[model samples]
Target: MCGIVGFSGKESKEILKRMNDEIFHRGPDEEGFYQDKYVNLASRRLSIIDVLSGKQPIHNETKSIWLVWNGEIYNFKELRNELLKKGHKFYTDHSDSETIVHLYEEYGIDFINKINGMFAIALWDSKNKELILIRDRMGQKPLFYSFVNNEIIFSSEIKGILKYPYYKKEPNFEALNHYFTFKNIPAPFTPFKNIYSLFPGEVLIFDVEKKKKKQFKYWEIDFLKTNNDNIEEITYNIRNLLEDSVKKRMISDVPIGAYLSGGLDSSSVVSIMSKYSNSKIKTFSLGYTTFLEHKNQDIIAARKISNILDTDHYEYFMSPQELIDDLPNVLRSFDAPFSGAISTFFLTKLISKHVKVALSGDGADELFGSYLAPRLSQPLYYFEKIYKKIKSGYQLSNEDKIKLKPFENNIKFLENLYLKSNGNFEKWKYEILLFKDEEKKRLLNNGVFEYDKFNSFDLLKKDVENLKALDPLNRALELEWKTLLPDHVLAFVDFLSMVHSVEVRSPFLDYRLVEYVASLPGNLKIKNGNIKDILKKSLKGILPDKIINRKKEGFVLPVFWWLKNELKSFIFENLNEHELKNSVFNYEYVKFLLDSYYNNKENDFKLAAKIWNIVSFKIWWDLYFK
Candidate 1:
């Protein structure tokens, strides 16, 4: 719940202060600074754990090691008790982050292994003349660093590093290309060259004397299935682990609330919170003012859950025009190009008004197989069987061929069992893509020299190649758990929530719970069209039947409808032909998408997603680059 900025080079307290000032919203309660011959560290504190005495740049008993941490270590109390037994003295009882410094003194760099929580830690070892940066195992908190000009600069947010006078504002087109493809530029790759985000469970140590840096991985999810897959035992274990995770996350001196979206995930969290709390729990939700037809049901569902739990519930309704008005601030808040903004931005803003910390249901979808990939695989499996029979001898009528349209164009792809069965890694990578390869070639300007050696798919390919799961569903889930959930979902949540000085905790992201779920067989998660089947069974009587069975409507905005109706003029103004011509996209192709949408020729929601991608990127490019 704070921001940290530090450097292992020429020390300047003023420059460090400027970097710290950029993220004041992250920690407005107080600020701290520490400087030595080799390192300068600055921090802004939000005072979540130890309100009066908890501060940053906290040191161990000897004061040889200083730590600026940007998250809550849920297991800090337990660690503190252990350290006390070992004769470690503590100066303050108000801070959980202080344990980090003592742990470092006791165990050195391996101290990261002794704690469990979301954190981005910058530790300076005066004795060793080195600076170490660590990101939590789940990637719940972000840490960005740059090794340039014979120095290493690191910060909780990228903007902090950019504040360094030596760093210039230059775009990383390779990252932009990857962003366009994945809807997000994955970790270790930001939208800027020579600057990188530390991957989850990653550690970077920089030696100031040698001017050298080395990175290593300390943890990753093991996707290996456990043979003890007794359904009852597994379901009971999931329930127990999730409850313990929620209880651990509720450790705070300040008030905490839940984001009750009424979706299965959020609803489950709220239900669990109500079970554990004697007082009424505060829950928040958001809906669109325009698309009542699509959103009203979710709102009603949220109200029903609130009433059943007897919680203090708050709801906010936002219009499409409000989203258009807030576009500039939204784009600026994210340090990088992020496409999933509308609902996430507004939801965080709405909740921040009432609570400083809120729990969300982010990791459930990836961990429990609740996304489209799992649900689609079941139908696609049958489709694969039908396609094989068709190829063997079945003949289709001309009308049938016409009905298939473009899918008919790639008959080989259709006939490929792996593609249909979710075994084709490349096909899954491109599934629901914002733009296809030819479309990218058409959109990007020829002058925009593609980075000669970097393939946009290298990260995706590496993730695919490393899948150890024998089950196609587990493999897909593992890929997303590794890449999408942490990079896209957690990244946006952290940046946007921090923008309002709000801290968001995700019980679903608990490492113990995640590892257990990852070890379960894929069938337990998704079976016969039931997504999160095991989760539902575990919470069978705990949650309201309506909530447990309700279709997943994740913080969904009415973007498709808005693009067609209320925001049409805004889209035209932002995505004009002149804008496209001036940038890396083809003006003709941009015009065609708008024309098709307006003329009602290609009004598919997928097309709407593409238009949004272009519009959002255009705004981001102009804001950052111009």
Candidate 2:
């Protein structure tokens, strides 16, 4: 619930303040600063815990180690007791962040192993002449950093880093290529050149005196290693771990609520939350207008759960015009390129009005299994089978390649299957990218080098290679944890919520819970074509039977309907060929997407998604780069 910014080279109080001010919405309650010869650190505090004297950059008892942190350490009180036993004294009454510097003092860089929470920490060790930056094991918080003239500048968002006078303004074209492919850039790559996001479970140690840096991983989730086999026992353990995670996340001093989307994940979170709360838990859901009297089953399910739990619940339907109006604000909130724009934008704006902290079921799908993956796996497997045979003596004929080219944009899932058949890792990173390899070849101006291997998926090929021993389901889940969850889902949630100073906590993403679930056999996660089978079975008695059996529907906007009707003119105005003729996209390809949508193509949803990607990219480009 705060924004942290600092520099290790030049000391500029003005730059530090400007950097912190860029993300003022992240911490509107108060702001603090700590300047020294080699470091300038600042924090915008949201006043979540120890509202009175809990401020940053908080110093250790010796005053040599200073800390500025963004996140909630749920186990701070317990860790504090352990530190107290070791003869450590604290100044503030109940500041969760106070334990970090003391723990670092006791354990050095190994302190991260002993703590469990979502945090991005900048700990300045003046005595060692080193600055240490750490991101949580789950990557719930984001940290962006750049090295300029032997100095390292770090901040909670990219905008903060941009405030530095020496920061580079060049766009990373490789990153833009990946953005178009994955709808978001994968980790360690930002849209701007020379600026990078820290990977989850990564620890960065910078030597201020020597002007050197070392980065290494402290934690990772390994799905190749399976643990329990007893389905009943494993199910029991999962429930226990999830309940404990929810309890831990409810440690805030302010009002908290749950996002009950009527999906199994969010509903299960609300159920567990109700068990722990004596008062009615506030729940929220989102719905939209449908012309054909299409019943919103998610809203119906949400109402049923809220009524059963007897909680204060709220629902809102978003109009296309409302979303169109807020598009600019949504575009500005992202620190990097992203595509989970519409739903998250409206959902966060609605929920922030009711509570300061909200718990969500964000990681359940990635940790367990998603329907889309399994549905496409068979096609991919069959294609790979044929591909291996064909490659033995037959390569893709030019005519066949051309036939497949059109389908790439029309059915990304099928194109992904085809890509996998050819031993390409691109599909693993984004099973359905905005554009395929061949399309991007035509789209780019042919100026960038190594365009073939520029995808974020290629960067993570080692991860896929490492997990070759695991079942396909588990392998897909592991890849998602490394790519989709951190870069897109968590970033979207963090940006939208922080825009309104609302902190979103995901119990499903707790490292312990994630690891435990990952260790379970993939068969339990998905069985007989059913996704999240174990999760659904586990919730049998706890939730209403109807809710448990509900069909899986994504939390997405009705963009297909809106684009052809409500927002048709808007898309035409913003995404015409004239505007994009001088840009990176191929004018014909862009025209094809819009023309197909307008003409009501066979794959209408695919066409709509393509349109959305183009519109989103154009809007973001105009706002930040233009």
Candidate 3:
């Protein structure tokens, strides 16, 4: 795991070094470079697999294809054997970076499909005179690039791109509007006007001589259902696939551990790891010093599971002051405005103390229909059907009435939304999105309105009607797999974990496991209103009922309580009207959000999310733009 940064022009090497220095935390072990007239590539090395001689930019035997990549190629050993059989020679003892150049030489760009790992790669093809930038199938690693000043600047983090001599700080107002909808700006768009984030599974090939570029998506989960409908068989296959994924991600030369939150996803991964390893597995978790409304059951549950699995365990309790002190670094980590799970920064900091690499159960919820959006998708589908029936003069059945009982307020909210919004409200998007376009009109200042003609709804509206063949639940899940997982959750995870120079690998994010989960019937995933029904069933015997049946409490924080007490002054101080009047938001709307939540008792967590997104954006804007 490392951070890669460089440009493709005859600028001073000092600028490249400055860009590389920005991400020293990503690769503190060493730094390597490949500078030439056509392109200059640099990597900050974390030294995961082959520490001594694995320094990159690893090149082909002819030195024609030089590669600087960030991530672990879990199947590099197997790939190396295949390459060796074909008469490919390697320079390092057993480095994944070396395997990449050899594979590119043999199979060309198709090698990306053959490799199984999380990575963001920048390869200079000297013979072809092109710079190839690739992001992994899951966006476990980040890659940002820009076309400016007759060159292309790319980096593992956007801060590296900012170190360029001629780069300006114009805001992507379209992305700022979209940022209000999600915790982070969705990919293909960043907060910068010129710079862009490469979408997951996307590859950008740039011709250095011509200064032209082309991008293609090599992988995507279609959420296409397979005809395999046997629940028992599907569950059995899930277990096997998860076990194999866990074993593959455990390939590391340095000390490794697992982030055990005691939820089903983490517990399942930890239990499987213990079975595969001969020694005690190291597990890490975190909790709060105290909570008012929110619960901190994760520490308690993690301790119980550690005893049950007989593993070495570590736990940390965080004070509010620590979070406040590190808030600036947290905002800086994501490289944009972000609002969810700031406490994860602390968890990764704790894990980095004991291990160089840590395995997490991050992708399971996004893969299975377990998140709040997916949970609502099932009932919302039924509600929409029932509403259409009533509009057509059909009488509702007792079963239909029973289902609607739990969602009466949800129905009213959508009804109010219809009169307020531009036109329609999709099942899950309207409810789950942090803020709608309609709300943006009232919340954003005239500056955002003046910088118009861009559609914020595009984020939610992409491919909605096109995937009509799949069930409503599957469609919602697939949209999240595309947007929420990669753009928001995984991006946040990668940035925060890499801050402490710790590598976070997720077994659930393995593309093989993702493809299999996508193939199964959607009903099996969220059956009878139960989220991840299939996953919980598959682990019935392996995990005790207490663990399996536990509610999903991810590295959660007490945002609602903090807003009222601990972080109250910090929120208002950072969200200064002086800052808001000059920025994109309306100061009145901002004050209304704060006063309603903090003073007038509108204490819904959703409102708190809105307040934080705006506040976080202000902090980020002040840091970068000022």
The number of the candidate with the highest lDDT is: 3
**What digit string (tens of lDDT, one per residue) describes model 2 on residues 223-256?**
7667745878877888889999999998878889
Instruction: Assess the local accuracy of residue 7 in candidate 1 as a C-alpha lDDT between 0 and 100.
Output: 87
Q: lDDT values of the candidates?
A: 0.82, 0.80, 0.83
lDDT of 1 by residue, 1-626 (tens): 79999887777988999999998988999999999889999999988898877777799888899999899999998999999999999998857888899888889888888888999999888898889999999899999999778999999888898999899878888788877777888877899888999999999999899998889999988988475868888888889998888888888898889998888888888888888886788999898776566578888999999998899999888888888888878777777777774476787777778788888888998988866565544444445545656768877656445434334455565455455435465565466556655567777776753644355656566768887876767877888888888788888888878888899999988888988898888777876556788999988888977788887767867787778888899999978876666676777888888888788855688778888888888888888886
Candidate 3 TM-score, C-alpha based:
0.94
Report the error of model 2 at residue 274, Å: 0.8
Clashes of each: 1, 0, 0
List the candidates' TM-scores in order: 0.94, 0.91, 0.94
Clashes of 2: 0
What order do candidates take by TM-score, descending? 3, 1, 2
Worst 10 residues of 1 by lDDT: 399-408
